[model samples]
Target: MRTAEQVTFGGSGLNRAAQIRGDAAALAQAMADPAARCLPMWRGKPLLRGDGLDALGLIPMDHPVLAAGLGKAIRAPVFLGLEEDGAPRFAHDLSRWEPEELDYGALGSFVDRSEQRHPDLPEDMAFAELRRVMTALSPRDAELAATAKAIIGWHATHRFCARCGVETVIGHAGWQRDCPDCGGHHFPRTDPVVIMLITHGDAVLMGRSPGWPEGMYSLLAGFVEPGETLEAAVRREVMEEAGVPVGAVSYLASQPWPFPASLMFGCAGEALAREITIDPVEIEDAIWVSRADMMTAFAGEHPTIKPARRGAIAHFLLQNWLADTLN
Candidate 1:
């Protein structure tokens, strides 16, 4: 797995200043510093700049959009980290501000092409869905955007303490939530998911969900249940979904998939048998695609099989497999 970190959202060496997360005075100084910049997000979308939406729209802390009552802030900004130049980075949720002429239908689709532009922001800047533009961003921007989305999404969902049903307050510079009533502490959560590339001879296992677009298929994946190892999850998922027993499982690479919050563990496994008996409840359909056909699909020439979305771990693993670089 030499190229493991080379995966889209894994390799960026962003210096997440963890030490300052719990330091109040240090956090204040960093926030007040003139070099601090904030990345504004709206409804899980990060503001992207340029005509191609290839860059993050990081604005100054004192920018007009951040002014009180002008552009609403859902909550205080969460400290992201310091840049290579020592400037502080933070994520601001402007989800409270509603954009005009918003396309409600395209907001949460599998392929949301809609982009939201705030009237107060420049024309070149608009909040674009992260999945739609993840590959276009630089490695550093991808990492930062992913981190911000995961953390902010966590805060949005976990506003109450599980221990006492009391409302929790943001703490640790957005890294933690504290229950004042019960003195309970909760941290951001990242669920582990195993997405495996199962192979039998020269073919691979592929499946499609019920709601996915026609002909769209990807590697079989499932959340790693409690007390289950990555290899065990891969074997169990493949067996349950496609009735294919897997052996000789090995790690390949990983990606930070922040659709909400997930860390995808990409693995490779050898199929014990090729006979397919798909579980209808777990998947709509399952098929064994030969390497040649897979190449055709990747080239967008296959008549009935569409490749996985680019920038996703499934695509990364399949691309490496086709390139003979899984080692």
Candidate 2:
């Protein structure tokens, strides 16, 4: 689809510097260069230094504040990429800095709001949630943040080898984990999820989970089961959650959802029936709302239903559908 890359976290044609990742000598030189800059993530939240909503922030790699932290890395700093000017970029996960933890439910709630200030950095910087500010960020920044989050999150969880149950060491400039015992190498994993825009005439299928904020309904989604195609996953998820059979599934767009790493495949499917037999365990409620009502919800005018948050694939897909602009 034409709008595929317009989604938050879509690629921005950055040079990932893959060739240098495995070259120890080159990586060491780049790390020592004055052009090296890093984005520090604390408890999964990245530090920020922008005043405007759309600004991009960078922390100098040699800055005193980050120097001490880098020396004490939980692991090697993950190399992000080089900018157009060849400035090296890396992301450092500093969950150990001040001993704060990331609670998934409260991720967007400011990580360093009341923390002690460092003399080297500006005082007004905000470490805001990536999701809450994704729409406001440029596509490039969004992609950078998402990439950093996914790789760092992966390193956080995959500290040991699955095959040998042995400790693994970071390698390939943070892109790989090597296990000495098993002679195994592991890369970051991205879970595949299918989010369906199931439609019956003018209405679209949406559901709410038990713990989501009230009135926050979104496209019916589920992880793609092993050996399942995207279309099959979409069809299966809709049926399992809402008991609505789906047919003629087609791809729409995709988004990289990095709340601990997921690659969301947005799909459209034809709903064969409208009657919902709620699977109480999977979803709290299922409803088919006409395009008109969906518009109202999108505008935040619906009495009880709220639209999917902006910047999410659900919002993007629904907005395009409403305008008949899906390509």
For every candidate structure, what is the RMSD over all alpha carbons to the true structure, in angstroms?
Answer: 1.5, 2.7
| TM-score against native, each model | 0.97, 0.92
Clashes of 1: 0
Error of 1 at 284 (Å): 0.8
Model 2's TM-score against the true structure: 0.92
Local distance difference test values of all predictions, in order: 0.90, 0.81
Best by lDDT: 1
Regions more than 4 Å wrong, model 2: 52-54, 70-73, 99-120
Q: Residue-wise lDDT of candidate 1 within 97-138, one digit each (tens)?
A: 777688898986888999888887899999989999999999
In candidate 2, what are the lDDT values of residues 18-54, reduced to their tens digit?
Answer: 9999999999988898988887776666666655535
lDDT of 2 at 144: 84
Summed backbone clashes in each candidate are: 0, 0
lDDT of candidate 2 at residue 60, scale 0 to 100: 74
* lDDT assessment of candidate 1: 0.90
